[model samples]
Target chain A: MNPAPSSSATDAAPVLQAAGLRKSFLSGEGSIEVLRGVDLSVMAGESVSVRGESGCGKSTLLNLLSGLDTPDAGTLTWAGHPPRGDRRAAFLGMVFQSFYLIPELNALDNVLMAARMLKPPGAAERARAADLLARVGLAPRATHLSTQLSGGERQRVAVARALMNSPQLLLADEPTGNLDERTGDAVIELLLELCRETRTALVLVTHNAVHAGKTSRHLSLHNGVFQ
Target chain B: MPWYLYLALKQLFPAGRKFPFFTAISVLGVALGVMVLVVSTSVMGGFGREIRRWTVDTTGDVQVRADGGINRPADFLAQLTKVPGVVAATPFAEGVVMLEHNLKPSYPAVRGIDVERVEAVTPLSKYIYFGKLDDLDDDSVILSSQLAAAIGARVGDKVEVYSPLLIEALKSDEAYLGRELRVCGIFEIGHQALDSSLVFVTLRTMQDLYGRRGSADGFDVKITPGLDPDEAAARINAALPPALHGHARSWMEINHDLIFILQLEQNMIFFLLTFIIIVAAFSVTSSLLISVVRKTREIGLLGALGGQPRQVAACFCFQGLVIGMAGTVTGLALGATVLTFRDNIVAAFTRLTQSEAAIERFYQFKQLPAHYSASYITAIIVCTITVCTLAGLLPAWRAARLKPVEALRSE
Candidate 1:
């Protein structure tokens, strides 16, 4: 079940929520129904995992939650209100299975890119980005090109990039999928560590159940519903 | 602002990335268009300046004559001078008589002028290339260089000058009727049409030969620039008594054919070569469109990443402008260089053809002495930049209306 904030916790709403989220894809053959009805919630400083098999709607759910794609039939909300469109995606940080780091940019540049894309929060954005990169233990390697980094190194940078703007919620889909077992564990630890530091809510998708156990809660996506 | 154009330009220089061949071709097309603009426009501009010089300096800005041939009015000169903006009015006593040297046959043209007044109006005085304007003594006449050479006359040589401005010569004698004229000077004037055609002498000489006294056969007027030739002519016409009408001619009314042909040629060249610029702009269009297609995912990412569609549009539009501006600037440079060396270019072509006969047959002028006018250059540059901006449209449109998820997902 989705968790709610404790009374002792500050009177803050869940950082992210999705109610009756449904998405479907259409082809010439007919249509494919991926997410029939899904609901999700994560409070601040909480980490939740969605462990699922392939062809499920885990990624599509993330797409809708992040406002990168529209939902076919449900409401998606961030903070308290429904995210109207792409601009709301700013409050949510998204990382993917492939890292999807722009290859031409250096690690630091990629991280700073997101912060810069946000309408100016004033002059301190650059300082904040550098400080954030340092917290992720990527400060020394900040200027390194994406191609020069190992697979595990790239994911750290991507994670650091996602956390650049001190986002309210961070969603990662198999961020460590391409990494070795050791690298995957290290990247997960770094993600959880950063989440605690920022008091940000986290939702991670993974195939590794053992990894899911490390989160505060975990769920299985079975038959278009989360359990 | 989208951060995408910066990304695109950065990617352009990425390691292992080969140059986009289309960019090179676009630059070349721009250069070619600019080259055509410089060369053809310069030639046309040169021709216009020459025409203005031909009209203003050679034929006089305005020419006035009387309606009837035989009636020479005594008060006409004073009346013309009284007209506002009449800079100077001069009388000419002209009629037909046979001109000949010891060798060739005699020919006749409208003949005499007040030497000083003629100089004030016509470029003939300035055209005395080898001799002096002061050389037209009372007994002396000036023949054009071509005519002088044809008759073999030089300073101190005597030849017969004859005017056939009237039909009296035909009426009087079937035999050669003429008087002596000492050749005082010869002129080339660079006006080939007039060189072999006109002969000039004092008005007193024409009055004696044409049997006209008091007022000469007709008079010519030089008008001030501020004066409308027609308006001045109207004033002179109104001032005159009903017996005579002041018929003053503006330049186009006189050399209508030459000017009409030149203007038509200049306009034809301009309209024809405008297509070249249009094609160049089309190159910008295609280049920008291709750039948009190549960077579709980038645009989508920018849109997804918080860029307004307007910023995305600016990115592609900036790319188009960059390509266009860079190309136009480079083209202007290359065009100017080509114009600077156009003569060598033509000479090289002549040498490549290897035919003295063909060289003699083809070129209008030996070297293309381009009249460098700033207005023409400005026009070419402005028009090309405008065309380049228009060429940016399709790509900018695509950039503005892009859907993020669909674009990135397709990639």
Candidate 2:
């Protein structure tokens, strides 16, 4: 697989660029504008955090970045080209606050499942999944189902799964929201280390100022624009 | 395995978890439907086969009759027996006659069959429960047990037999003779119609009685084993002389109305029983709907992991297919077991209730009959699986149309 464009190449072209993004929702009788206009950019191997109040569209921004949802009006590009449909998942991996590990599969299978979306995993990919699980400190729990794992361990597995396909960027929406303070810090630390080791750009969305402060660049969303 | 199929299997039979209750009920529903369909089909097939066997045994495989009486029955019988599939042929004369016995008169059909050739073409000799069939002679006759009982006659009792033609002749002031025939034998074929309304006499006696010295009514032809009676009849008809204007009919054609009624009843039962399977498919639909609702977040997760909408739909469809296949196999096994032990089961019931009268009154045979047809079973399985697959489509489509963001938001 092609390595995510190197930091030198990323210096010439950012990994992701978005401008004039807008989104809204229909309330009882009126439309609620979540984001009026937003502009953001993240370079390769860079870690950025977006901190906002609840309902301020932090998750919405992450969703748009992951291509899980579409902005009402905007131009969002990955490596200078629009990410289309499932190709977005191939280019970018997502980790959710709830640690959305499929309950039916074991930890190892869950990680492998993400790889399977791009292509059928081979022996080498299996080894990489094993390595990633070990990196997340859940190697011994590889065969344990999600139901059997602790909340922190499930989150770690989710983080491991997000990097399985060697995506160029990882979009984490409140990755530590469901964990206690200490467990959440550990999960954030592990997530940061993995992203740094792989040189994958990170877009972490959170409500915690301390977690937001750990990233290289910190931005706050207010009135639908980043500050 | 493909990822979608793997996911489908995992969702259906999740490891380390008890199987879901609603899914189990759906599977049971499908199994019950398939069981009833299979059992009913087998019973109906058995009934049809038995009826056909009885009809063929009583009427011979084919019957050939001329427009009028066959003048040279011996030559016609020779020609009939020469047909490729024709195994045996017998000449017989039939007419309505009145018999006076014990000062009582009754009308019954009198059939005159050649004693030597009758045994070759029919099971009439085997059905003679009392007396000897060979004892029938010029002045003697064999009466069905029911007819004999009706007339209060027995073997060695003399009875006067009068033909309608003979009666007409006498009424017109023409010479006619009534024969004093002795009842020589009594036969019971266990067929109510034949036993109650038919009597047997020698061919020469019937010829003399009817005033046709060398003519007979028809010839009964039995085909070789495994040959279709209709095809055999057609061949015989084609070979008959144009001047004779003879037509050969299969036993089924002779009892067309009865056979048609039986077939119609079987088809209606089959159609009605299929509804059971259809109803069971509704359970499948409901169960899948529940699963879809429960797994909404997981569906969104799959979508985020790059699963196509069509693939997501296929996962649920595969789940339904597995359930259907499992039910079909179990039902087929259950049906086979039931059919194999049907007689034993009935006997046990009979013993428990101490009732044999119901069986004797309702059925013509001592044992219940079941016929297993591979083609019919295949059709049932195919139809059941198709319905089950279709049942999955609604939920599958719903799942496919789900937006990943909305689904994930539910969690």
Candidate 3:
């Protein structure tokens, strides 16, 4: 379902590295281990796609990589350092299947929120947010509330928000799951194009095999391990 | 601004929205509680103030009295006026008399006042409603408004006064005739107790009727403005000789029981009305809890976007603070407006209910009174803001405890 990265890409150090990562959940009297010592590495400017069926620990892996959840036993690093709460905002960004745009804020404000989390947004941050919105082709609808937007438009806004802080790595968990096939294809294309143009790394979790094929590297997960 | 506070404000007063139902309702609840506290406390304070004013107006700032009638009042008066804070002093005599006009008889307390010095001490002329204080002489008397009505007497009417000495003279087997005096004026003091049962006569007339010459029961002392009555009374007590056995008491010390009851009532009202603000705080807590539950997914997204748990908690906490501040401001404005138009509002309501006369009969006030003290207003602000800020804690804790992974999974 995928191809290996080019020789030039592997020459650089990986932006995200995870090894021996494990996680579990309580199931009745006993516990069930969801992730068992998983290991992965991705280089700079690489778009890596992970495809899996439901409940295959794909989201759990994404959570651990983003530092939203702790791995029971593993070492995970972003740019060769352990994830810290204060450093998380400047190191990475995330996009969700639900798009998760705050309903109270407009499209432009939702994008600027990422930068605001890092620091108070100033003129440069505002310009970047506008440029990102224009890149996603939602510039004209920047002032519209998330509720007033359609599914495809909301995902585009989410993509713009994910890149607002110019983070090195973006973790997207089934971002296009809520949109139709044609819209999903367009979002995936725009996402890859933006990542490549900015030289930012991406880890996309998705169910569509065709969308997975478009990335620089693709992997399938089954029985809690990548194959 | 911090992102958390900025987002908090945006959540409460969202951009491009016409109506914010949650914020409006929450603010209104807190505002109403604050308004009631302000209005009720001010009205209670007003009643207390009015009582003090009339008490001092009727009795002067201080009254000096002896065990027996003071002998040679002229000497005591000279000493009384020489006190450091004493501005002036006037000698007075008091006794009960049987007053009869056109065969309608009433027993009323009568005060004998020195016309020239009484004005300097008690402002008695200000309360005169009919005729003039200058018209009162040894052959004339003044009646309280209600006492005049009871005897069906008016200015220029002749009334017979039977002093207590009449009974004493009769017991001694001596003939005594009641004095006939012309009514010269009627006064209304606006105090139910004082206005209903009192008459005034010249000091010389009272001395002759009581068979005491050149002597008076007590002297009313007026002190310098802004001087403490109790302090001035202490000064006056030190000025008189021990042989006179004279004791000076401030108006507050004389009306101690009434003042105590008024203070107790105001404190009880303040204690009871504070519960209203507590109830409003509970409403705020409930609303914020609901908001936290509803926004679980968005909160998870924030965590995914690198927001710390503490910052997320701050978002909800700031919302409560904003609501508290807005409600306090609005409530103060509303309370001030209502207090300004209190007389008109009372008039309209009394007219609508046809209870104008009933209010005067029961409350003894023709117009509603309101007073706002700095201390009481400060207490209200501090308590309301503190409770509202504390109300946000539970919801903030609940939000902070949520794990981003679990919250995202929640349906």
Best by DockQ, which number? 3
DockQ of candidate 3? Answer: 0.80
Instruction: Specify the highest-TM-score model's number.
Output: 3
Which residue runs of candidate 1 sit more than 4 Å off their true CA positions?
A1-11, A97-112, A119-123, A126-161, A177-192, A208-216, B1-24, B69-77, B91-111, B122-125, B138-183, B195-199, B205-221, B225-242, B253-265, B343-382
By summed lDDT, the worst window of 10 consecutive residues in model 3 chain B runs over: B50-59
Model 3: fraction of the reference interface contacts it also forms: 0.76
Ranking by lDDT: 3, 2, 1
Candidate 2, CAPRI quality class derived from DockQ: medium
Give the local distance difference test score of model 1.
Answer: 0.72
Give residue A120's error in model 2 in angstroms.
3.9
Chain B alone, TM-score, model 3: 0.92
Which 10-residue window in model 2 chain B sums to the lowest lDDT? Answer: B357-366
Clashing pairs in 1: B95-B163, B95-B164, B95-B165, B96-B163, B96-B164, B96-B165, B97-B163, B97-B164
Clashing pairs in 3: none
Candidate 2 lDDT, B1-411, residue by residue in tens: 678888888888777678666667888899988988898889878877777766776668899889898999978888888889999998989998988898888889999999898888888877777678888888898998778998899999999999978767978999876789988889876556667778899999999888889899999889999998899999998899999988999998987887788678767877898899889988898889999999999999898888889999999998888889878988888888888998898899988998765674466555677888787898899998998998888889999998899999985
- Residues B14-106, candidate 3, lDDT per residue (tens digit)? 998898999999888888888888988898888878787777776789999998889888888888878899999888998888989999998
Q: B153 in model 1: Cα distance from truth in Å?
A: 6.1
Off by over 4 Å in 2: A1-12, B18-20, B93-215, B224-228, B242-245, B344-365
CAPRI-style quality class for the chain A–B interface of candidate 1: acceptable
